[model samples]
Target: MSVSRCDIPLPENFRPEDILAFHRRDGERLAEQVDDHGLKKGLLWRGLPSCLELRFQPGAARLSLAIDGAAAADDAGRLASLGRRMLGLDQPVEAFERQYGAHPQLGRLIAARPGLRVPQTAFPFEALAWAITGQQISVQAAVSIRRRMLQLCDCRHSSGLLCHPDAARLAGLDADQLGQAGFSHAKSRAILALSRDAAAGALPLDAWLDGVPVEEISERLLAVPGIGPWTVSYALLRGYGWLDGSLHGDVAVRRAMQMTLGLPDKVSQPQAQRWLQDFSPWRALVAAHLWALLQAGGF
Candidate 1:
């Protein structure tokens, strides 16, 4: 195994530990591990199991990364890209903060957690698959099912840590296999279709990240079997790190909005949608803040 290391600069007030904690929250033992030093995650680099370690100091302005395993020594460009996505470094956080830092509804929340970000999966297909798994399910249930699916794929690094399975590994799976991992029939078909489409290059998953119009990407994703507005929006948010996707349809978003608004009645999807429209390009970022509110015990 080879080892490669590099340091990535961070923007002012960017908090790497918050990103670390988010990844740690739903960590499946085999796929990744997180602690004070930083995150040690298993992933596939060039179709080989590789380990990525991120180390940083509190209040530091940079992150140090170490990539280990086969083909790990070179590929500086790919590893840096992966690190940025994993840390949400490409997000227009400062822009969002500048626009909404003083807004009445979100101002306080943003003030309390200035470093909040919408953490993304390492791969686009991973986000899509996770979105399918989470459809209409409780977060806890989704995590359990996701852990099971990871075990089912069984792609492990040389260090014996399991890597998050890529589209090809997932595409080879059948409905029965997914069902055994707690996927409903509809979800199984949806994930299988998404995996096959991605693995076969039928879906423009990567291009969506490369400046495609959001409407076109949304339309394409919505065309897939069993994919709905919520799934498409969520995949766009988590996969592309796009902050504009409307997440009002999400139950947690509505619930958190209700709490933020101090409303006695539940915040309906339409009501939340209308309210969130005010944030426009930052709607999803606002939604992320509300979700963080709930996670931070504000609800």
Candidate 2:
């Protein structure tokens, strides 16, 4: 299969590590799947033919981004719109900086990488399902379960690439079937419940966006049978690009924060909540940055 490539101006001071972290969270491990090479700023990947690649570059007044795929030329405008939406372009970074400035660690990191924004992933349902798959398990174990579930429920394109299983298809599954896909009882229940809700239009995954209040959306998300605080927060950050949402209960985030800030132990939930006061409306960016810090061995 022939490969194609393109580049867009990355958000000013964008770090490759941040993009790679977002891609990892999105379950797009092009680096692992393809024999490819390039800087994070202008990434290039070759995978199963016709794979989509997206990037964001910060601009003076707005963000500059690029999307490359066999279909990219036709989808440039849509891709650019998606990029703007994903990077929280609608929010003023200065506002976020003012609120979160008290945290020297977070502030320093942001300074080092100005105009840094959390890149959003496209697959919202997949993201929710993956979060459930990851609950209480090691990252490797989560990946294994996700692979099994996708293999059982997802269909491969003509080019041999797998797309996320559709809501209808997955909604047809029972707990037994999901368990066979390596999900535990709870995880299986959660995924099926999520699929059913999404399939029935109870949770309108597509319509949720940055303009919506994080707390409000999270409440609705929690109404789903298997969704919880962590899952809802994860979805907001990764699925909808809400810059102020934080995974306060997330073990990794807690650990990363403690280490980054030199706290002796993980911040308590209340403490985390208080900490978030410094990052309101941009807590999501702080969460992304902390996650990146963890990935980079800084925490």
Candidate 3:
């Protein structure tokens, strides 16, 4: 099959560093390892120095953008829209400050980080699959599992990008093969069930981002086999950009929040809910900021 690519102009302030930071936070580097599994590389179109090369696979998509500091004059409106969508410009920073003022530490920390918004990403399947790979495992072990899964199931695009396995591909695998790929029995069944459901159109994983209520979406996600609160919450934040979905049960998040808030011990779920009340509609962004802070040695 022939490959196609398209380029879109990015906003003037679309810094590569910012994209790198968000991608790093969402574990995009790990996704890259699985790119050759089944992802397809499409056409290459350029908008002169500020173009984005779009890649579309069966169940995932990503754009490789070339940041141009000098091309700001060419695509102002497009850039503005991109900026609004990506930088949380739609959110009122003042409102965020007003609501979170009681937790000065959280507010001050976010204020100091200008580019702390959760990135708009297109690969829900990749995000979900990664979350499963991470279940009850260390980050290093999760990475290894993901790498092995990709190696076992991935196909390469002409551009050498590794595409993650499609649902049909994964659904066809038996339990033993999945176990050989290092997936525990429960995880293997869950992954296969999700893949089969996705392939059969039973799960509208991609459509939940279109202004659906957070609780509704969370409930639907939880109905899937093997997906729990933490998985759904992570998906809400990473896949659909639901800012209010606080992942209170996440070990890393709980630890980070405790340290950041100077709590003597890990905050309980109820306490976390109360503490996170101020973040409200933008709690996901706050979580992203806290994660970044944790990674940077603040926690």
Q: Pick the candidate with the highest TM-score.
A: 1
Write down the lDDT of every candidate, Cα atoms only: 0.80, 0.60, 0.58
> What would the per-residue lDDT of candidate 2 be over residues 189-219, giving only the tens digit for each residue?
7788888888898877766653566677788
162-277, model 3: which lDDT tens digit per residue?
A: 44666667788888988998999989988888888877888766555457777787676688889898787677665665677766766667677888889898778777767676
Cα error, residue 225 of model 2, in Å, equals 1.5
Error of 2 at 82 (Å): 3.1
- Rank order (by TM-score, best first): 1, 2, 3
lDDT, model 1: 0.80
Candidate 3 structure lDDT: 0.58
lDDT of 2 at 235: 74
Better lDDT candidate (2, 3): 2
TM-scores of the candidates in the order shown = 0.92, 0.75, 0.72
Candidates in descending lDDT order: 1, 2, 3
* Of candidates 3 and 1, the better by lDDT: 1
